[model samples]
Target: MRCQPPSTFQVYIWLKSKQSCLLCDETTDATFPICTGCETDLPWLGDQCERCALPMPMAGLTCGQCLRHPPAFSEVVVPWRYDFPIDSLVTRFKHQGKWPMGRLLAELLGQSLHYRFAEGLPRPDCLLPVPLARKRLRQRGYNQAAMLARWLGTHVNIPTDERLLLRVLETPAQQGLDAKARKQNLRKAFALADGARIKDRHFAVVDDVLTTGATAHALARLLMDAGACRVDVYCLARTPKPED
Candidate 1:
């Protein structure tokens, strides 16, 4: 008699027992691919702006910009400051098609969110990924934000919706642009899909990184205008201010 193929559950169990660290490639007993040392060495976000997650000198203070001009999103929750290996991992996953890197990051992010929820953060009704422009989607072959949202949803048990929001305009890349220019570039750039029922719903917007937050602001404003009760931003990393 021939040996039978492994069941899906058996395959899952086998893979779990044979895991290797994605960073150092060492065999790791941890549930995720990262070894404890590598995880400890990541540039975790320290004190940050309560509203924007901007790296700050001290905790419990909102940045001046947020106090002066509040953003549409209520709060930002991020794990790392965009630097070194975290930035490298994100770039490889996003631009180089290293999907395992993305999966590792998403798993870590989901764990972080679970901690936050336990610490009194309300879970959102759903997750909405920032919509990618169709042109860029074709070039990259996938939307990294959408992929993150889906993986994170699976880990966290939150519903993920890739189609509720639409990118209406194909704006120039926001990279290297000042905050003002970025805001201008995103004006009229996003819209809610037809028949999308956003009224009185809380939502978390998922993305790989949060930089100037112009994109988050634009999307949050659109959702709020559609009557979303609250909006929060969740990302793997956050870029510090230019001078910081």
Candidate 2:
């Protein structure tokens, strides 16, 4: 099933319930499948670099680095580039407490997952969002990644173990870190929340974006070490790597 687009249908329903569109505020009648307006605006990594899902000029599957050294996870699925309304939406959700948009993004994700992962895709045994640090979670009032996972699970019928991954250390943000620096900076940054809960399970790790993939890689590393049979990264967006 190709996932449906982000429906204006959800926005309409939500506005009808609240008597106004509050920008992801109302949880009542908040659950939805897909929306209308989001059909085309949700961009996809069409014929991208298989390793990172970065859009490539050529049609080859593997990028050089991925051929030389494979990543920790089985595959990477990215629906859109991290820019424009999405970048703004993410900023609002993460910084201004605009939570409903997270569901909106999830709608787009479900659709993209269908197109990207293929039909009859087996849902992971469980879904997880990369855990936020205790301080960050407290300060932000919510974890955007967890919210995304929740809505994604609701749409696709997968159980989301929201707490399966734990941030064991609080490291500097990866905003400016190079890929190599990112891996090093994230050493011991994460762990299985309770290894017992995740043992022998396949986990689909969800996040808002993939930028150097440092965090995703590190989290995937710990997930496998903690007994996850496989880890597939699902992100709303993937940023292009910087050119030298």
lDDT of each: 0.94, 0.74
| Tens digits of lDDT, candidate 2, 87-123 | 8777787789877767777876886676645765456
Q: For model 1, where is the 10-residue window of minimal lDDT?
A: 7-16
Top model number, TM-score: 1
lDDT for 211 in candidate 1 is 93
What tens-digit string does per-residue lDDT give for candidate 1 at 1-244?
A: 7477656435333435657889899988898999999999999999999999999999999999899889999999899999989999999999999999999999999999999999999899999999999999999999999999999999999999999999999999988999999999999999898999999999999999899999999999999998999999999999998987
Q: For residue 87, what is the lDDT in candidate 1?
A: 96
Candidate 1 accuracy as lDDT: 0.94
